[model samples]
Target: MLDAVLLILREVLEAALILSLLLALSQKLHLQFRWSLIAVTIGTIGSWLLAHYAYEIADAMDGTGQELLNAALYSVVILSVIALGLFICPLAFKSHLENNLTQKKIFASPSGKKLIYRLCIVIVSFSLAREASEIWIYLSAFTHDTEMLSSALIGSAIGAGIGMSLGASTYYAFTFMQKSYFIPVFLAIITLLAGGLSMQIAKQLMQIGWLDSATPLWDSTFLVDEHSWVGELLYALIGYDSRPAPIQGIFYLLTITPVVSACAWHAWQLRVKTHE
Candidate 1:
């Protein structure tokens, strides 16, 4: 039961965090949650399909198919996250500068709103599909063992409840922040989240022998136990690993640099426009 809880919690927490972030962004943009509903439905079906075909998928690409597929999904997720940050920062900053919750002039266009809506949907759908597929696969493995199956199911429920509750708390915390701080906070979290995902891609590539592995860059487990609740939260928020490989750090930096640079440039442009 404990093993099941931890496994399910990790997967559920990841999806929950991503969904909560994107949903919070949607609210900030004055968008409806209709896209969220569609995304959830698509994600549920996708997870079932992926889990149903797991063996075939694992068999493909000379037994490296699963890693390759996961890498592809992670890449898509990272790119989508970067795109969201790049697109939303300016609008959010504009709203902040105007000192309004709704940027009427900026939010006037249906196209802009639709684009953001679609991005959020894509992020949530792909993220949920990837993360929840693991849970589905785990639960399916114990189907023949009724005794263990019941325990796994109960553990999964508890894990999912805890994960969702944490995610909701995060969303509400964001809602309570002042507008001036929200833009930076949102962008920082988005950037770090994308970097963490890129680390996942690096791990997948390494597992498939596509990328060279290296020694651990550093170990912070002495300061914070990786299995603790705080560690789990950090992992969900930023892909925190106590002893990440050097390649993971490299991937993290590579992903973060461009996002930071782009956001800085966007902020600069916004400042210049405000002055003009």
Candidate 2:
């Protein structure tokens, strides 16, 4: 039951974090909540449909279909997050861009602003869809055991409460930060999430023998089982892994390094231009 609680909490929190961040950004731009609410409704319906077809989906591609579907989701999530960062990063530090031609932030033009708003809807939709699918699958596993089902229901309620509280906390925290700090911090979080998704996609691929998942770099299962409450929370927040494969670790680091370095370089260049 503890395992179920932690797992559900992690999945719920993942979506919540994405929605909370997007909601905070939208509030700043005066974007209507209707669009976001519509997205929430659509995602909930879509995920339920997908969950209903889970057995057929899992049976596809010689029983590797589930992994493939997960990989595809990671791809969607990866793209949406990166695009969201591109749109938000500039607006967060508009003063940093100097030239009139280049100074037009994503939200400067009507079309561009609409594009950002739409992407916000998409990112939220995809994030929720991904998490909802997992939660549905996880809960469905306890249908046979009445005791487990009762325990799971209790666990889920508590898990959801914790997850939502964390997401809300993150939103409020961002609201209190200075713009200079906010942009970089926001970008960093987005980048980290993207990298984590990439690693997860790789893990899914490995399940089908498409990529090497030969050995763990180091085992931390002794320290904290990922099924534990704290470990599961860390997994959602920062991509923690107890028995990370070398391939996953390598690619995860590779995925994050370039984005972080590039963003840092651009911020530095902006600082230099400001001085000049």
* Top lDDT prediction, candidate number: 1
Stretches of model 2 off by over 4 angstroms after superposition: 91-105, 144-147, 271-275
Clashes of each: 0, 0
lDDT digits (tens) for residues 207-243 of candidate 1:
9889888888889998876788778778877988888
TM per prediction:
0.91, 0.87
| Model 1 C-alpha lDDT versus the unseen true structure | 0.83
lDDT of 2 at 142: 88
Model 1: residue 8 alpha-carbon error in angstroms:
1.4
lDDT of each: 0.83, 0.77
For candidate 1, the TM-score is: 0.91
